[model samples]
Target: MKNKGVVFTTQAAMIAAIYVVLTVVFAPFSFGSVQVRIAEALTILPAFTPAAIPGLFVGCLIGNILGGAMLPDIIFGTLATLIGAVFTYILRNQNKFLAPLPPIVANTVIIPYVLRFAYGEAIPIPLLMLSIGIGEVISCGVLGMILYFTLNKYKHRLFAL
Candidate 1:
């Protein structure tokens, strides 16, 4: 890609914007005890570009802030996304199906505590984990797989080499 720096920056910014818009548009399903954040499907983008690591982080930060998230949610929730994206980028060489696992695992484990401490939700941790895990399976597993394949075809054109 010509002007590789600009291309990478632009792609990352676009990914971040798309993530924020998707999360905000589905804000109801994007947060809380059982979250099915459709934007999480894009967590697979790191397989295509390292830029996705930061893109997902910034997008999640903005999403949590605009979703009326509390302090712990804002801090820890974004941290989860950051960790997930980094892991996803690191594991990019593995099977495409596995790329979304980090985000799924990270959020499944961390968000339950965020709910309990941040919102004082009365649900037990195990149940919250199960519910959140299931939602993540849908969002980051099923939907992420779909996005992976869809973008895989255009990745050569869409991302910096």
Candidate 2:
């Protein structure tokens, strides 16, 4: 039992670390006015374990800091990610295909306004939405489903949730 607990903790920590690293690796594409946030693809992992809650939140917090977000973006952006992660966590066990979608949608809807109003961009709402939403669709819709399928295949033995 103790060994199992240790193993779980290690895996959870590893997930958090990977999420952070991936966010950093893609930081340029993950932040700024228009971002794809390929790392958000990993948000689908919650379907495999509850630890993803903290893993994702901490990852987003760290990314926001390193990504150079101001107070409003940090607070609101992180809140959006947290909210989407919670939603993903709630339905994680029910449908893995749907897990990553909420974060994509949430970020797409919120980040555009953040870019426009918060960052002082003169970007029109619809155009901003188109650009940002396309990025998200590529990230979450394409890559998310890929990760979901890959994880789903090994969910029983590898995931341990």
Candidate 3:
């Protein structure tokens, strides 16, 4: 039991660190209106292990702080990620194929408001939605699917029992 707990803790921390690092590395595309937010793809891991929820939320908080957005970015930005992660965690068990889409959808649905307000783009709502949603589809939907397959293949070895 001790070993299992240690493994879980280590795994969660590693995931959070990876998420923060990825967001930092992709800081340019990750912030402001036209965000790709590739790190969000990792949210699907929560389906396999619940640790991913906090792991991702904490990761986003760290990313927001370091990425250098002022108040709104730290507050609403992290809030958006937190909400998206929660939505994903809730629907994680419904279907393996469908699990990744929730976070993508959640972020897509929520991020446009942030973009419109934070960046003040003259872009229309549909355009903003399309841009953010498409980005998420590529990042969370497409990349997340790939991660799902990779992790699923290694579930026995990498994940907790």
Candidate 4:
């Protein structure tokens, strides 16, 4: 039991660290309204482990702070990741194809407002939604699905307690 807790903590910390690294390394495309946020690929992890819920939330929070995001972006962006991760975990037993949908939808819906109000972007909300939605599709849909497939092959070994 103690070992399980340790493993969970370790896994969450590792996920958070990797997310931060990916976001920072890809900073050019990890912020702003027109962003891909390659780190979002990790969002698919929730389909494999519940630890990803908190991991993603903390990672997004730290990532936003490190990326110099405004207050609203930090709070709301982190909440978006948390919401996506929880939903992904809840749907983990369903079709594998559905795993990334939550993050894609959450980010698409929430990030447009963040860009408009937080960053004071001049673009209209609908256009911002289109752009952010595109980025989320690329990040959480395309990349996340790819990751999901790859990790599915080693789930027991990588995620086992």
CA lDDT scores, all candidates in order: 0.90, 0.78, 0.79, 0.91
**Of 2 and 3, which scores higher on TM-score?**
3
Q: Which sections of candidate 3 miss by over 4 Å?
A: 3-5
Q: What is the C-alpha RMSD of each candidate to the true structure, in Å?
A: 1.0, 2.1, 1.8, 1.1
Give lDDT for model 1: 0.90
Residue 77 lDDT, candidate 2, scale 0-100: 78
Q: Rate residue 25 of model 2 by lDDT.
A: 86
- Candidate 3 residue-wise lDDT, 1-161, digit = tens: 45877777777787789989999999888876677888988888887776677788788889888988766667776777777777777887687777777777677776777767776768887888888888888888888889989898887778774
**Poorest 10 consecutive residues of model 4 by lDDT?**
1-10
Clashes of each: 0, 0, 0, 0
- The sequence of per-residue lDDT tens digits that candidate 4 reaches over residues 59-100 is 989999999989999999999999999999999999988998
Error of 2 at 32 (Å): 2.0
Put down candidate 2 lDDT per residue, 31-109, tens digits, no spaces: 8767888778777777777777777777787778877887777777777777777888888867567787788778878
* Candidate numbers sorted by lDDT from highest down: 4, 1, 3, 2
TM-score of 3: 0.89
User: Candidate 4: which stretches are off by over 4 Å?
Assistant: none
Q: How accurate is candidate 4 locally (lDDT)?
A: 0.91
Model 1, 35-118: lDDT tens digits are 899999888888889988888888899988988999999999999888888999999998877899999999999999999998
| TM-score against native, each model | 0.97, 0.87, 0.89, 0.97
Clashes of 1: 0
Residue-level error in angstroms, candidate 4, position 148: 0.7
lDDT of 4 at 69: 87
Pitting candidate 1 against candidate 2, the one with the higher lDDT is 1
